[model samples]
Target: MATLTSVYADSTIVLGPLATEAQPEAYDLCEKHVNSFTAPRGWQIIRLATDFAPAPPSEDDLLALADAVREASRAPRPAPMPAEHRPRPGGVMPGPVTAPLPPPPEIAEGEVLRRGHLRVLKGDKE
Candidate 1:
């Protein structure tokens, strides 16, 4: 995979490293597409000599990932609300109580084999 930058003023196309963010004027090309690219009339193509290998995770990247994981794992504290809106210490929450869920339907022939939300059925033999 490669990132390409087209210079309209210079009429040149440059192939370089993959960008971390999406650019308004840059394009990310696949290996097959990049290898078989064609420029417009009067346009020149320039390929950088740098290897486009996947970069290893840096210390800062690892530390940032760890911090994010820690933040996400920690339970979120409840935000303070107005006294009138807050529920009583031992009272039930003031909302409609949900009815108990009904049991699932009984399984049959076609339902014997299931694929996700679909059922595979056996066709009648001639």
Candidate 2:
């Protein structure tokens, strides 16, 4: 595999064969199409020296991956509360309690209007 790229600034196109060495500016092309390269009528084609060796991973890429893994490992884990202080699985907690309020007085037939779960009661005239 090789790469072919058009450099608009210099009005030139380059065909570079793939090598272990990396050329930052070149785009990779399929091996089958290397011999079929062409350019516009006025453009010039430049052939770059190609090396077949594989490029080594950059230091920055390795460091970034290590930093990401370290950060994920450092995330805070939730602390478990003591059994006595924790709420019972299905029971309410003990607290200062008062008598429950009585239910509302029954509504008279004509004075109450019901809609869905709501109720409207006519006020007693003074």
Candidate 3:
């Protein structure tokens, strides 16, 4: 029987390299897993299947994936107002036409009249 070298989880658990004619220890791993499992490349990761070795994505592939994720995160968010809640063209806005300003503190009748006249002259009467 042919010996198999398979990995499980993140660790390299070599299955029996049991040779039909030889002992179990004669079972050395295949070239692919040998280079992958032993070397500690930062970005190159590998997953192995029982029958065949899973191809490790190249550095360019990983970089492209990372760039896509970053771009998606930075994409512009939708505006706060929903389409239905948005003010239609030529339609009145929902909030008060203008919020009322706080009234001035109580003052003598003469002062109040003078302030009123000044407001009118400045075209700021409300």
lDDT (CA) per prediction = 0.76, 0.68, 0.49
Residue pair clashes in candidate 2: 2-29, 19-51, 19-52, 20-52, 20-53, 20-54
Error of 2 at 94 (Å): 52
Q: Report the C-alpha displacement of residue 94, candidate 3, in angstroms.
A: 15
lDDT of 2 by residue, 1-126 (tens): 667777988889987755446667767776556657788888998877554333567998799999999999999988998455434333465763344444445656765755435678788799
Report lDDT (Cα) of residue 50, candidate 1.
51
Poorest stretch of ten by lDDT in candidate 2: 82-91
Which residue ranges in model 2 land beyond 4 Å of their true spot?
19-26, 50-126
Question: Sorted by lDDT, highest first, which candidate order results?
Answer: 1, 2, 3
Which residue ranges in model 3 land beyond 4 Å of their true spot?
1-52, 82-126
Cα deviation of 17 in candidate 2 (Å)?
Answer: 3.3
Q: How many backbone clashes does candidate 1 have?
A: 0
Better of 2 and 3 by lDDT: 2
- Cα lDDT of model 1 by residue, 8-115, tens digit: 999999998888899989998877778788999899999884565556789999999999999988969789984554343334656653543333445576555554
Candidate 1 lDDT for residue 93:
56
